[model samples]
Target: MCRWLAYTGTPVLLDTVLYKPVHSLIDQSLHSRMGVETTNGDGFGVGWYAPDNGTPAIVREIGPAWSNRNLREIADHVRSPLFFAHIRATTGTPVQQTNCHPFRHGRWMWMHNGGITDFHRIRRELALAVDPELFLDIEGSTDSEMMFYLALTFGLEQDPPGAVARMVGMVERTGHEHGVEFPLQMTVAVTNGQQTWAFRYSSEGASRSLYYSTEVEALRALHPDMAFLREVSDETRLIVSEPLGDLPGAWNEVPESSYGVVGRKGEDDLLPFTPQPV
Candidate 1:
């Protein structure tokens, strides 16, 4: 449905992750091998946390990323320790800037690569469930942004995985009430400048592709002469919809129905994820 990537650890130009890889996000926007659509041209967005800003900065547009001059210009200039980039292929929503990915609220940023099955059938129900105060902040009509707000309503700031599970639970419950057998499909990423969390899950068991980069130390040992590996820190990590490149031993699949966290101290974790009733 979409392609996205979350990067944490080491401050580097956005280009390092967004444009430089052999099979970079920009390239994916044009010739994606792992997404439902070969070209994700409906829209694109990038959100990054600067050292001095509390809230993340976001740039979104309703255009293909591969040909966006502004995106290319910014990627060459902006640098951050953590950031998210996404290319969208609308499931059914209109192609507008607000419908782009990497949605933001306060210091947090989020993006997704899947959708709620038959969202229009359950859209009104799900929107009604969001907290009134938080619902006002929603600027997009995509299920991805709706999921973000739903997670926020369920306590994303305090407990990310729990909030997301609750959000998914609500979606599944609502979908079932509407007679939809498969309710959700998502590989989501969320961050609050300091830490990043990623999830891969769906109601039917089969989910979209998701991968995380191999540990920097391990990659270093595998290819000692790679200068880029030497430039970044041992704690550096990246989670993407697909492997950014064909580097040997460079990516690992995130387990089905599970979530992972990349923390400040390199205390990353992978654990089982289960939807809980709200």
Candidate 2:
């Protein structure tokens, strides 16, 4: 239902991917090859963790990313080591600024690329499960934002994996209770400024498309002639909803029902995720 990418590595202007990539998020907004929809223009948002501050700055609006002049101007200048960019295509939610993805809370930033089936049927029940503190932070009416709060309610700050897993489990249960056969569908990304975690999964086992770049050093060794590879740092890595370019060895498909974390060169990690009761 949407397209997104997360970047973690050496700092660079946001345009490095927001515009420079051959099939960047902007391109995906209008010509997605693997997303459910070719155009994800309902709304858009971007969150970046600047160097001096611990908190990320988020700019969200209710316009299409492809033609938003403000997005273009900002991308040309903003630089960050960790950032999330998303293009939205509404499944069942109204198109509004608050409903945009790349939702932010405190120092954490989150965004999702899919939906919880029949969200309206279980919205209240699922919302009631969130911790009152976080529930009060809810500003939109999308399953995506609700999922974020549920993760917080389940203790995301203490244990992100368990909190997210429990959040998914709750969505599945809530959906089933509301008579949806396949309740949860989400490919989500969440970050705490210092670390980033991205997941690909769905209740039906067929998840939205997601990919992560191969190691820059490995890619450099594999295709030494490519100028872009020679220029970027060895630690630079990108996880996206589609390939950034047509480069053969530039990306690897993220396995369904799994998650990946991007940190320093030696700190990148991958792990399996499964639904578990809260």
Candidate 3:
């Protein structure tokens, strides 16, 4: 289990989201209210896309985020329109830097807050299913990273939602073959420097908590005096494992078994998500 957030909007210092909220990601690393664990201190990572770079910059460390001086400094210095921050609580993998969240490919970034049940039992099978070329790029042993590569193999670069659904379908099919009744759980986020997509789903129908920020225009109407809301663009939004603060009408729970897209053209969407057989 972990706590993560994705931001796509006007460029702002990472500190505005990671450490400024009442229940910020850094705060969640020690006092999370809605995660499986109260403290997610196994490791931490942040990835941000600069205005000119197609590939995002990621900083990961195998240590508690709450005490990480480097993360604090980076958060204060970096500004980007799109970014992802995650605090990890290991399920079964080693607490190593490579195993941290916000895993990267060529120009895409991904992070997950759930696990594939009995992953050790089906690891070899799933590994064998990945495209050989993409398989060579896997840098971590965690199921989260494996899912990223699987999605890439299944065509993430061409179709994000479809690729993820196919990835889930493959995991579910393989898990069933191995006798694991409920094999998947995830609250995932993916971005390629422009738009961002978030999904909440589980094989058992009870997914983990996930939320997206209310529309900036709507929030402005509700909290007229909030200076921060006044500063960001109407297209700005945040998708998170949990709400960042207690601001009334500021967060909306993502529907169960559904996915939302915060698009670059401001054509945001929330749609039903069903795992498709690969």
Candidate 4:
């Protein structure tokens, strides 16, 4: 399990979200209150798209984010309208930069906060399912990375939700075939530079915790004296594994088995998500 945050709105320095929050992702790396583990210090990553750049810039490391000077330096300097940050706590996978979250390919970036139940039993079948053309790009040995590639093989670029449904369906089917009772668990985030999609689901009824910010204008009215609210755009939004701080009415839980989209024009939409067989 892990902790992650995705920001989309007006361009803001990365530190605005990564470091300034009272319970920031960096702080969560050492003291996560809701994660399965209290600490997620195995490794970490951040991905962001620069203005006019279709591809994202990714910075990852194989050490604790709390003590990573490089992460702090970059966060203080880089500004982006859309970005992703994750801190990891290994679930059997080795701790390595290549195994970090916010995996990227071309203009797309993906991060996950759950595991493929009994992944080792179904690994070969799932690995074989990835498009051979994309197989060569697999750089890490984590179920989360494989899940991203599986979605890609199922046409993620054109249909993110549909692709993920098919991906989950395959994982569940493979798990059942191997005698696993519940096969999938995930709270995932993906983006293609323009629109961002965040999903919460599991084979079991309950999934991990995921929340998104309430509308900025509403928060402004609730806390008129907060200077930070005035600086960001009305459309400013954040989707996270957990709330960054304790601001009342500032965050809303993403519905179970549903997905949300933050579009290029700053439109927000929530839709039901269900796994479908490929």
Candidate 5:
């Protein structure tokens, strides 16, 4: 349905993955091999942690990314240790800036590359599930954004994976009540700038694609002559919806029904995610 990537590791220019990869995110917008559709040109967005303020900076527009000169220019100049890039294809939802992915809530930033089944049937109940105090912050009509807010309402800042599991459980329950099967689907990326977490799951048991980078040291040993690879710190990593290129050993598929986080210490972790009905 869409293509997205999340990176958390060494600080590097945004283009390293956005434009430099052979089948970059920009290219994926026009030619995706694993997504439901090859063309995801509905819109694009990029968010990164700035050097001055780790508050998270975002640039989004409802236009094809390849045609955006501003994005091209910024990609060459801006760099960050953590960032998110998304290429969207609408799923029966309005096209608008607020609907753009890599959404922010104080410290957290999020984006998604899939849709919820029978969304309209369950939208009202899902929305009503949000805490009243937090519901006012919602700014888009897409289930993706609502999913983000739902996670926040369920303690996302304190626990991203837990919040997401809770949100999915809620969606599944609502969908079942509405007689819709396999109601949740997503390849999601969420970050607090300092740390990042990604999830791949679908109620139908076949989720969208997601992948993460190998450690820089491992890559360096495998492809020693690559100059650009040498420039990056040993900790550098990238998670994408598709391999940026056909480079041998450049990416690894995320396990089925699982999620991973990127960072030092316990900040970067991955665990099995299975939501029991509530």
Candidate 6:
């Protein structure tokens, strides 16, 4: 239902990925070959952490990423060690800035690229499940924002995987009660300025496309003449909804129903993910 990309590693100008890639996020916004829709012109948002310990800065707009001068300007000038960019195609939610992806809460930033099956039917139940304190933070009508708050309510800051699993499980249970099967579908990314966690899961076996960048050294060896490969550190990694380019070995598909972590110390780990009841 949308397209998104996350970068964490050596700091680089946002334009290096958002605009300069062979098939960049901006290109994906206009002619996405792998997304459910070809055009994600509904809206877009970008969130980035500063070089130090601080909350992330977010810029969202209610228009196409391909044509947004503000996005282009920010992409051209903003340099960050980590950032998230998303182009949205609404899945029944209104096309407003508040409903955009990459929803933020203090130090955390989240974005998703799928829908909660029969979300309208279970919206009230899910919303009521959020901690009343976090409920006030709900500013949009999208299921994605609701999912983020739900995760936080379940302890995202302390245990991301567990919290997310509980949130998903709660969603599935709610859907089942409403007579809907396969109640969840999502490719999600969340970060707290130091580490990033990305998940690929759905109640059904099939899910939206999600990929993570291969190590920079591996790409350098695979494409010896590529200059950009030399510019980034070996720890530099990216998680994306689709491959940024056609280069082989540049990206790897995240396994079905699994999650990957990009740690602050530059380590990467992958593990199986299963939802647990709260």
Clashes of each: 0, 0, 0, 0, 0, 0
What C-alpha lDDT, on a 0 to 100 scale, does residue 50 get in candidate 3?
88
Q: lDDT per model, in order?
A: 0.94, 0.90, 0.95, 0.95, 0.86, 0.94
Q: 46 in model 6: Cα distance from truth in Å?
A: 0.3
Query: What TM-score does model 2 achieve against the real structure?
Result: 0.97
List RMSD in Å for every model shown.
0.7, 1.1, 0.7, 0.6, 1.4, 0.8
TM-score of each: 0.99, 0.97, 0.99, 0.99, 0.96, 0.99
lDDT of 2 at 250: 82
Model 5 weakest 10-residue run by lDDT: 261-270
For candidate 1, lDDT tens digit of each residue in 74-127?
999999988999999999999999999899999999999999988998999999
- Residue 43 of model 3 has an lDDT of 95
Model 4 lDDT per residue over 1-278, tens place: 89999999989999999999999999999999889999999999999999889999999999999999999999999999999999999999899989998999889999999999889989999999999999999999999999999999999999999999999999999999999999999999999989999999999979999999999999999999999999999888999999999999999999999999997567989999999997
Candidate 5 per-residue C-alpha lDDT over 1-278 given as tens digits, one digit per residue, 9 for 90 to 100: 78998876667889887998889999999889999998998888999897568688899888888899989998999988788899889998878888888788887899998888889888998899898988899988899999998899888999888899999898888888889888889999998877788999989989898988777788888999989898877777788999998878888999889988777332456788886454
Error of 1 at 259 (Å): 0.2
Q: Model 1: clashing residue pairs?
A: none
Per-residue lDDT tens digits for candidate 2, residues 1-278, read 99999998888899888988888889888999998888988989999998889899999988899999999999999988889999999997899999997888899999998898888889999989999877888999999999999999998888888899999999998788778999988899998988888999999999999999999888988888988777778888899998989988888999999998877453788899998885
lDDT of 3 by residue, 174-244 (tens): 99999999999999999988889899999999999999999999999999999998898888989989898
Worst 10 residues of 2 by lDDT: 260-269
Ranking by lDDT: 4, 3, 1, 6, 2, 5
List model 6 lDDT by residue over 111-143, tens digit each. 999999989999999999999999998999999
- Candidate 1: regions farther than 4 A off: none
Model 2 CA lDDT for position 28: 86
